[model samples]
Target chain A: MKKIESLSEYRALLGENKKTHNGIDKNCFLLPSGMEKFISAGKVYYRSYDQGILIFIDENSYYNLYYYIEKGSCFPVFSCEKPVLIEELSQNGSRDAYIAANEARLKAAGFGFYRKSFQYEIGIGAEEPQRFCTAEDEQAVKASGFRYDTACYADFRPQIISLWKESLDFGDISGDDLALELSQDEELLTVISGDGAVACTYLYEIVGRDVSEGRHVVTNPSYYRKGLGSFVLGLTLDHLRAEGIKRHYTWIHEQNIPSVRMHERLGFLQNGRSSIQYILK
Target chain B: MEEMMQILKGVRPDVDFENEKLLIDNKVLDSFDIITIVSEFNENFDIEIDVEDLEPYNFNTIEAMWELITKLQEEG
Candidate 1:
């Protein structure tokens, strides 16, 4: 029901509402609280309770929420770029009823529609400072095999995590935790070899089509001189480009020199695109 | 072991896969390595790996990685 327009406004709304939600902890919640940088040119909007039953609405992009329904104690609706194709949960019975009513309201108001991807895109290759292209280092770098394999979120950790624990950087990330984060859709990758793997880059979250972001790129001190960091990103970039994606992004701390340089090498030269997650006890 | 060594050396001439598990630890491979490897895997093996498949497990140790390559090849 609430339509927040500007980033500042969204922040204010988020601060006010995040406290009201349940199931969040005070510590270890690393994600955006309220963000609205639409990948499509149309304005992006998000409105959700503190518990994160948030709905991202963009005039440009689109989603089909009704298609994937997982029933539990209650299935919170996820992904409905348009209300017409969606149905929200309801307190009276199910979230679907609420979504249905909301859909009717939107239809009556003549506001149900699809906009486009955000005007600002995280390109892969660009001569510009912060711009990017679909693929980085194409035809330039040969596959020497020291190639790392990267995946996302915590739920998707494999045996290699425990096998190669001594070489982790990114400030003491354990294999178990990393695996769980991978399940959360966080971007995770590894540069691998026979006796070693060097850098590992991962993001806490990646959403929608406009942009996908990685959290950090952790390099092994032993492999500092080589361009392993660039290699991981180049691989990710090529995969993304192959999928017809237009933009990609990853969050690097302001002071992480190596990471910033690596992202710069990959062409994600923006100053910042971060969302602080709020946890409730 | 030989195939894994070949992949590792292909990625970097100075790689030491003997006691070093690449994905489990950041030793010889890094971002640059991942890109090159992904390209090679995609081209040499003729398989399209989705962005979602990029992870440590996919290219962790030589044995684990060989499993991925073998599986992908089989799937194809």
Candidate 2:
């Protein structure tokens, strides 16, 4: 195995391996551009193997590598600067087989299962219901002076980062990483803010042909149960629809019942895809 | 080509893969269907269909998919 040092080399290796394997891992296949950013930031380290490659994000970074070591890939044998989390996505029915095949090697490497999430998707059809905030909720938001709008990262970087850290447990994402993400598109982050406080936020990205993934949605605990979560998510769905996105995808932790219910209430359905994150810390 | 059509139809029985020229752009087939089709093509034709070959233009119609398969086979 050789460490990939340049983006061009990474791309070439990826192409060659795709031909050899008949297909590349979906995460790696879709993440070249993001990899470029992370590489430039000096936050990504990856090594190429015959079956596939293994990517590692810096221990202090928030950029999660949703990568899988192919079924027959060389076992990862590298050391990390800090505790590393390896997240793997597998088809629901194959989850057990996936674990059975890799768990031992992972355990030998001091990694253990961290968390699991269920993947859900909703297709935008002509007759699909348009669910947004109810009239009472809208009135309440207006009365409280809270308004939904696209946030300028430069203006709300501190609050955004603070709220992100406060509300989510994905780990510490560097501000630079957040900046890189927001720089991808001006309208990627939407927020409901009032009186200098960002109450709710939604971040999404176009992941594939006509498909958008809702990457993150968070509401301040102080603003919980005020319908801010639903309001922002509803508007995001509308926004994606207007941008010609036909399918929307999101992942919710298996233990996050409230979030799962919220997504289901808005028409998202489990699509038999789930992922487990393993960490060696 | 007929075998390819059968594979495509087997994966998505309701779609008219032969006539429809926008299987991907029109969102008629999702990612799962594409994965199944790629696996079938690779196994049946003994051709390696790389991720780069998963563009919409190569899968929007039955003819396009057949062209991709033939090209890959010739290369192989």
True contacts kept of each: 0.00, 0.03
Off by over 4 Å in 1: A1-121, A125-145, A148-175, A183-191, A194-206, A271-281, B1-76
- For every prediction, compared with the true complex, DockQ reads 0.01, 0.23
Q: Is the docking of candidate 2 incorrect, acceptable, medium or high quality?
A: incorrect
User: In model 2, which regions exceed 4 Å deviation?
Assistant: A1-8, A11-44, A48-74, A92-99, A134-136, A151-154, A172-176, B1-76
lDDT over C-alpha atoms for residue A182 of model 1: 47
**CA lDDT of B45 in candidate 1?**
68
List model 1 lDDT by residue over A202-272, tens digit each.
Answer: 33233433235554455555656666566656666665555555456554444556666656655455531
Candidate closest to the true structure, highest TM-score: 2
Given the true complex, what DockQ would model 1 score?
0.01
